[model samples]
Target: MRESLKVQPHHLERDAYLYIRQSSMRQVVENVESTKRQYALRGRATALGWRDEQIIVVDNDQGESGASAAWREGFQRLVSDVGMGRAGIVMGLEVSRLARNNADWQRLLEICALADTLILDEDGVYDPTSFNDRLLLGLKGTMSEAELHVIKARLRGGILNKVRRGEYRCTLPTGLIYDQSGNVRLDPDTQVSETIAHFFDTFSRVGSACQTVKAFRKDGLLFPSRLRNSQTTVFRPLTASTANAS
Candidate 1:
């Protein structure tokens, strides 16, 4: 049997994972250029003699801030792959591709070291096994951390701009409507809406959801569905009978 190749030239076994991301709106909306840049990474993998099947390339089309590892699905999966021994080599444009946050970058580099994977950057190929490469990784991770700070400031400014427009920024409750003409109006033809109001009034009348349910039940009211959670999304309580009903 042929000798099993170690990370050195004698060893030829390598499974490559390519992580591709375009973090800004400018990068996302530019269909042609962004894709070509990403595909170039694939071409790079091919040049290294990695088969199409052996190379894993993942793409995310979101304005999602990569500064924090908490929000990136692709990054999380890549980390998991490295940890699980699936990825023998990890390739990306820069350390920022792994994380913008300092903590995530440190943790990922450590994991790659422990798992014995090769990390490739444009500057050089990093093997955590070597002390010099580890130092380089630490420096790159620090730079990524700084880049994240700038991205956060820009995002916070944009959110404040939205709030300044008097648009209710968060989730809206049922009775309110943001109409076609950009007006916040109350919905008029809501039957469940009226019933829901009555349920709330009953809650105020009885002082508890249980008492509301009991009193409504005493009045032969119908409930749509029962839920036990505090943040229950479904509510179907019967409304007061109209006096005009024959």
Candidate 2:
């Protein structure tokens, strides 16, 4: 009854914009239920008096992060439509789905307020033009941003714990490999081991990275570089950057 009062005929006359998003491709693939729940909001729009054709599902943002609106084309389109008074109601499964950033969320709320557009989540219908609804929406946006921060903090803490315990496995640099037993060991290839030893020997003698690179170039020595994605090593002319990194 209260939801019906907030959604006016004027709102129903315009299109209902249903914005859908997931933070990562992993979520889009593994979290099938969540995606289905978001798409099911089309039925919610129908219940709010929007026809099938009048409901626009903006799902281009799938597998994209909500930390910012800079790279989200779907979010930009929704904001543009709302600002142009084309969207009668903007719907999402939750505020976090719409935007996890306070700036992006508040901007959307402001535009919806000015356009007299409604915001619909699983909770209830909210009229952004109404002061009370606007405040509640603001709080939800803030909470969404806070929620993201908390998740990141927890993940960082777990990674740091793993690092302290020497359990964190990082990519091995060139001339090093993780053996079958997952122990760090030198490359089995004698050429790779010899090249790395010679480079260091030159570096120690030259006492300068730039001079070491020049020495390799002058000696016409090709450095053995291991490809990141494969165990194969390729010999290439060593640049200052590569020498410095080594």
Q: How accurate locally, in lDDT, is each candidate? A: 0.67, 0.93
Write down the worst ten-residue block by lDDT for model 1.
Answer: 1-10
Question: Candidate 2 — which residues are off by over 4 angstroms?
Answer: 172-176, 180-246
Give the candidate number with the greatest lDDT: 2
Candidate 1 to native Cα RMSD, angstroms: 9.3
User: Which numbered prediction scores highest in TM-score against the true structure?
Assistant: 2
lDDT of each residue in 1-246, candidate 1, tens digit only: 011122443112556888877776666777556556656776655555567788888666256667677878888888898898777677787777556788888888888888788777555567776698889899888888887777779988888888898753554455555577767676554654676577778777877666666787788765433243222335454333321110
Model 1 CA deviation exceeding 4 Å by range: 1-7, 22-32, 60-73, 122-124, 158-174, 177-246
The superposed Cα distance between candidate 1 and the true structure at residue 215, in angstroms, equals 15
Pairs with backbone N, CA or C atoms under 3 Å apart (clashes), candidate 1: 5-11
User: What lDDT would candidate 2 get against the real structure?
Assistant: 0.93
Give candidate 1's error at residue 217 in angstroms.
17
